[model samples]
Target: MKLFRPATLVTLFTLAVSPARAWDYEGHRAVNQLALAALPTNFPAFVKTAEARERIAFLAGEPDRWRNITDDQALPHVNGPDHYLDLEQLEEFGLTPETVPALRYDFVAKLALARAQHPEKFTAIDPAKNKDHTRELVGFAPWAITEYCGKLRSEFSYLKAFQHYGGTADEIANAQQNILYTMGVMGHYVGDGSQPLHATKHHHGWVGENPHGYATNSSFHGWIDGGFFKKIGGVKVDAIVGKIRPAKIVGDPLKPEDLFRQMMAYFGDTEKLVAPLYQLEKEHKLTPENEHADEGKAFLETQLARGGQMLGDLWFSAWEQATEDRYLVTELKKRPAASAETK
Candidate 1:
């Protein structure tokens, strides 16, 4: 696989295992399955079909698969940073949940500005930093999902227009394909955010001044993602998805600034779970047979279910918001002019 930076190669080389992807391929597909099932009643009929679900589940791991591309190796790292955001890293820049910027590039610019001003608090970016930290220092997972949601909305609107304007079979098919790919891509990032490990400084393994003495082993990330599930027969998707609270869209979906508020809210919720994950490791409860593993299992299940619910909600909201606008515009454009006789 292609590495984003030299530092990334070193981190992977040292670890000997821990692939860059979050939640192994199996974990990603499992989450996609749950998200597909939990979609709102108003979701596109096509998405609910068995063929579409199978396609989406298979595509859910595309981001990870892109990392090893042979034809265009650079495409992998271009999106690699969209998987996680370490909220702790934003502190040096004074970017709390309330002040975090709406776009990924803006976030990085702010960090650079902060680094210039507070050289004492933050170290300059160097080749020595691990790839995970390099990405999280200004990760764009939240914004990436919001952007994809907007794209899905546009795709939905066009699909509706095809029906109204007598579009060809090819046009309708193309729109459907776009929608499926966008949803699959968006789901990957959203699912990544659900993993508490993906949001914290202690992503791959515990680091720095640990009084409680958590596991410093490198395999922690891989284990929580797939190993745990493989041993326990996967998460109880139905039970967990049923319990997750209904998704409530709070603001205008078309506006990224407005969407950012809700996005941050969801990210904050996931951020709160980071400590509990480490707590499980500290207590030695991350295995299927361990009596205390139930708590860890419960935490992972909740995160996965929440990811599904949020993705479904975004999909529904985008369709509602965009389709309405598209219909109005198309209707106005097609309306006949008033005759001179009537005037």
Candidate 2:
């Protein structure tokens, strides 16, 4: 379990000085549009419609849009941390990459306890400096994904109830819209994890020593992220949407235990990519014009595609698991279709 080196304290402190959001608005939309396009026919009907797909794609950018709120306004809610998790910071909570508390509050509580016991492990979580900045020391991104997944699953279950009862077209459409909107929000964090930088302390400028000659350019993050994608036509919605494929999950992710494990595993997988991202810059394969560049372009494509695929899989899994609810069967059988139609 690699921890943040003490040498990077100043760098981390500098980073903690403000609120930073992840990816860019366009990147979030691209990832979610691709995911929506890949949903199987079995998904809720509304999500498959052209209008809902467009709405979902647009809504994927909502979280970052909220960042426009001044830091003071967003801090208490920890909005800055919602976009990322610096995996090394987990060490301060006595958590390794392989282990994590299942709930967001549990993780926070544990971190608070760890800080109380060993004050030296973290910079102070002072309320004076932005709380969003302070809370970002242990980012909320992983838990955000899990929590949204649970919300989506609940929405799916309710949609199933509506379907089972032969609900009006408008009623079912409303439920479907709710699920799609939740999925869009969920996809944003999943997209963040794909960026590699979002999962590490070396996010913007390189932290610590310059032993590897990785990019230390402060502008590198924005230059390489959505800016590059928007500059190069290769990552556009049409270019990516056709390529998405759902992930093959080993188990039912809608189960509480499985959902937690799956999200952590997804985060860990993205965490591993951070080093390689630097290596790309180290090798000169990554650059501001990387959208048209060779290996760098391929890497971006792969990560974005992976994000879209995982989002689709999570959406499909929620639908599948919701169908298994005993309530669905009970509600369907309790009323005949003809009887339900009369009301």
Ten-residue segment with the worst summed lDDT in candidate 2? 1-10
Candidate 2 lDDT, 20-42, residue by residue in tens: 45567777777887777677665
Any runs in candidate 1 off by more than 4 Å, and if so which? Answer: 1-20, 70-73, 128-136, 236-241, 244-250, 254-256, 324-343
Give the TM-score (vs. native) of candidate 1. Answer: 0.83
Q: Estimate each model's TM-score.
A: 0.83, 0.84
Regions more than 4 Å wrong, model 2 = 1-11, 16-18, 71-76, 125-128, 131-133, 241-243, 250-255, 288-292, 324-343
- lDDT per residue (tens digit) for residues 38-106 in model 1: 666766798878888888878878888777663553563467667777666677578897788887788
The superposed Cα distance between candidate 2 and the true structure at residue 183, in angstroms, equals 1.3
Candidate with maximal TM-score = 2
